[model samples]
Target: MTTAPPDSHPPAAPPSTDVEALRREVATLREESSRLRRMLDTAARIAWSHDVRAGGGEPVAPAWQAFTGQSLEAFGNQGWLTVLHPDDRAGALASWADAVAAKRSFSTRYRVRRADGVYVWMLAKGTPVLGLDGEVQEWVGTCSDIQDQCLREERAAFLARAGELFSSSLDAAATLATLANLSVSAHADWCLVDLLHEDGHFERSLVVTADPAQLPLATIVRSLSPVPRDQPVYPPSVALTTGRSTLVPEVTAPLLEAVAQDANHLATMHQVGMRSLLTVPLMARGHILGALTFIITKSGRHYGDEDLQFAQELANLAALAVDNARLLQGARDAIRLRDEFLSVASHELKTPLTPLSLKLQVLSRAVKAHPDSPLAPVIEAHVETGHRQVRRLTELMNDLLDVSRISAGTFRLQREAMDVAALVREVSARFAPRFALEHCPFTVDAPESVPGCFDKPRLAQVLDHLLDNALKYGAGTPVSLTLTADGAAARIRVRDGGIGIAPEQRSRLFERYGRAVSERHYGGLGLGLYLTRTIVEAEGGRVSLESRPGEGAEFEVMLPLQQA
Candidate 1:
């Protein structure tokens, strides 16, 4: 070889044999094919080839036959179409026909029966295999398992809808009925919600079915008394008793017999056609309120872990809604009863107070008439003390009446042109004797006249309450009232040198029954500031407080000069 000419290069080693080159190419192709098959298997995708022109073709993909468990001969005759869900067949075929006519890529989603006899969602996509002339020769496609993804999306949508229904209102009966109806429409053929009452009794709160004709049969099923919790055959009872979810994948005749209460019950159960059931206890705040039962009928759907989880989520929402409604109703009833009691008590107390006031006035006059008598001073002192006590009772009765009126939505204001300065002076004079008794020095600063359209009696009441508050808590310290008019509003501030409120207590001081002091030390209902704030707000005004512990507190009221 070395002796040959440099240009020849020893015949180039026979050009590397045609058979060896072909073998290397074949090996490369085999490796690529194996990689593609691995990719398809890992992705749960089955590839198939169909000859549209011939209407059918022999199964060429072992994956397809393995996935559907179809024999080669059966698959050749298009037996795979039989595995498609009955409800989806018509639409799927129609889409395929359209895609074939247009000679374009095809994509669709449908439920397909698996080798295990369970239906799973699949996303099928296909592309036309074109020949050299750009005419379609056949179709190549893939079927991918999308069951988990579809179920997740479905569950999310269902819960979102359930949340909307639950938030619509705090009415228990209406909301539970809506929830039952929604369940039947989305996930169940029938839904029954049974609630456990406080008296340990069970009541079927709602029963809804998808088919209108089945309403009578549902009613019959509802009439059948629930099975005892000791018997684990009944799902609802089991769920309610254990406070856990129960799922019955399939309902058998023997199981139905075990759950039935009587012959009529068994007959009704058969007529209702329950195929599967899921029950979840309605849990709220660590308590089980009830059980929500979901039943499948002719749809032949089965309840699985995913269905149970969804039902549990729905039940949680339902429980919260029901609990909230019940709490709200309870509060309303309590308020109503309190208002009624206040109205009657105020009226009854007033009835006796009027005559007592007259008697005290008569007694005072008689004692004054006998000024020359030896017992004149003692009798006079006793009568004055009695008068003070009577006045205090009257004030309390009036406050109760006002609260009742407000609660009943009957509180009204009579606005009239009046001198606020004059009203403030009158209230101050009325409270003068009380301030003196408590040894609290009172001072008032105001203009001679501040003209405004306001509710006179209500304003007087507000002034009286503020002064009394100062007298009670001021503890004989100096109290001052300052009044000023500024730009469409009247500002009145009462500063009291007494046991000042803590910063934390100020926010709660304005709510009904909110108090910063104990009843043992303070001798009035905790309604004064609440009533004051309510009146001020109703008149387009505001009230605020400024104070620190052990420092004097100043309460301010700003009222619109003109009534709305």
Candidate 2:
């Protein structure tokens, strides 16, 4: 009835009792395989294999192609090496080769390239799969992206160290020193700082080379001799001038020659082995204050845009730190200037008193005749001097009052008939002590009487400035002061043996804050000559100078007999 009549087929095999169990086992294995693939996807890891005998390598599973977004053809025999960063390639390969030959486990970390040409940190690990008889059959490996974790940790650590260095001191120079030391092994081998002066000029402020061999070169460039002041060129100069960033991937002979101040400089560059350079202008509030330069010397490292970007960021912080330190130093300098002026003013205030004692000699006879010790002659002679000194003291309140007022075009003068010769004599006697201290022989020549209608106090100030300038710029040479009268005016001449003035500076000699000498060699407010000219012109007089470098300088002033 159940088709049993169809006995043509052989006897049907009995249904095994293990059939259902076998089916269950197969289902379990399928579930496990799916779960493993899901796990691989979630971990961002891809499996790969290499058959030593077959002489080829490929992804053991499709996960590698999916994760890397790369085609099989693109992943050549040494595809892993192609993704390895240049800096880490050699070490990574060496490690892998050793492991593959020994048929052992291996692990390493390095930057790997993605399909889009981006590089990232990756942890690659592999193990050898053995065949029968314990011989090596194939090698299995996995690749995972660890770029984010590694970069995050590294950045956090570096920033923390950098923050500590920056906060350690408010001194811009000191902070830069620390930065240079810390960055020598990491950022660059040499660090340089160029600072902008208030006059809109640049000077090398600092140079540091971690490598000892380059110290001499750094010294020569920074101290022995400096860049030409006339040329406003170079990478740092361009960056500062344009307020942008500049990069020099390789330091060529022509580049070195162009920047070299002399043959010796070019030779020094050869000894230093300069390779690459990064120049970033220190900018704040829309103005370029200076430039920070980082150089690769002896390291032979390639600096890319990201490197430049990081350098610029550090430069920004450096600029801020430098500005902050400068501000603080300025405040301190202001305080120091105030104190110095106070001391100088006090000394100057006392200086007039000594000259008054000279007048005392002239008043002795008259004073002796008065029964009450009249002291009338003394009082009469000193009345104007005391008033002038009092006014001079008032002028000291701002320390720069005279210069400021003159520059602001709000200066005024009071005139009277004064004996020019007598005032000159008094001032010369007052300067005797200072000249002696400088080992300078000073002489004064004046007629017995040279009368003029002038402001005595202002004339005294003018003489003081001229004399001070002569002594300061004299270079320890003799100074001479001469006064003579002409047909309509009285002339005073101050000459000194000093590093003299250049012809170009003659026109601006009397300009306010004009400097005819290097600050490293001479220092002042640059207001002395200007003040002399201003006061003399206000009194219907004129000022002039004559000089040549290494010869000496002579300053002359003319005072009209009549008021302007």
Indicate which candidate wins on TM-score. 1
Clashing pairs in 2: none
Per-residue C-alpha lDDT of model 1 across residues 1-564, encoded as one tens digit per residue: 447666665444545588799899999999997797677667755777788678776544677677777776776554667889898988788878898899899889998877766678999887898888888889877789998899899889988887888888899998899889888877889998888776778777778899999888878777766545555657677766678777889988998898776788788889988889888998888877889999988664688988888888888888999999989999999999988999898999889888998998999899999999989899889989999899888988888888999989999988889999999888888888888888888899999989999889999888888888988889689999989998599999999999999999998889887899899989888888988998888888999999987887999999999776
| Worst 10-residue lDDT window, candidate 2 | 224-233
Candidate 2 TM-score, C-alpha based:
0.41
For every candidate structure, what is the RMSD over all alpha carbons to the true structure, in angstroms?
7.3, 22.2
Please, what's the RMSD in Å of model 2? 22.2
Q: What are the models' TM-scores?
A: 0.77, 0.41
- lDDT (Cα atoms) of all candidates against the true structure: 0.85, 0.76
- Number of the top lDDT candidate: 1
Among all windows of 10 consecutive residues in model 1, the one with the lowest summed lDDT is 7-16
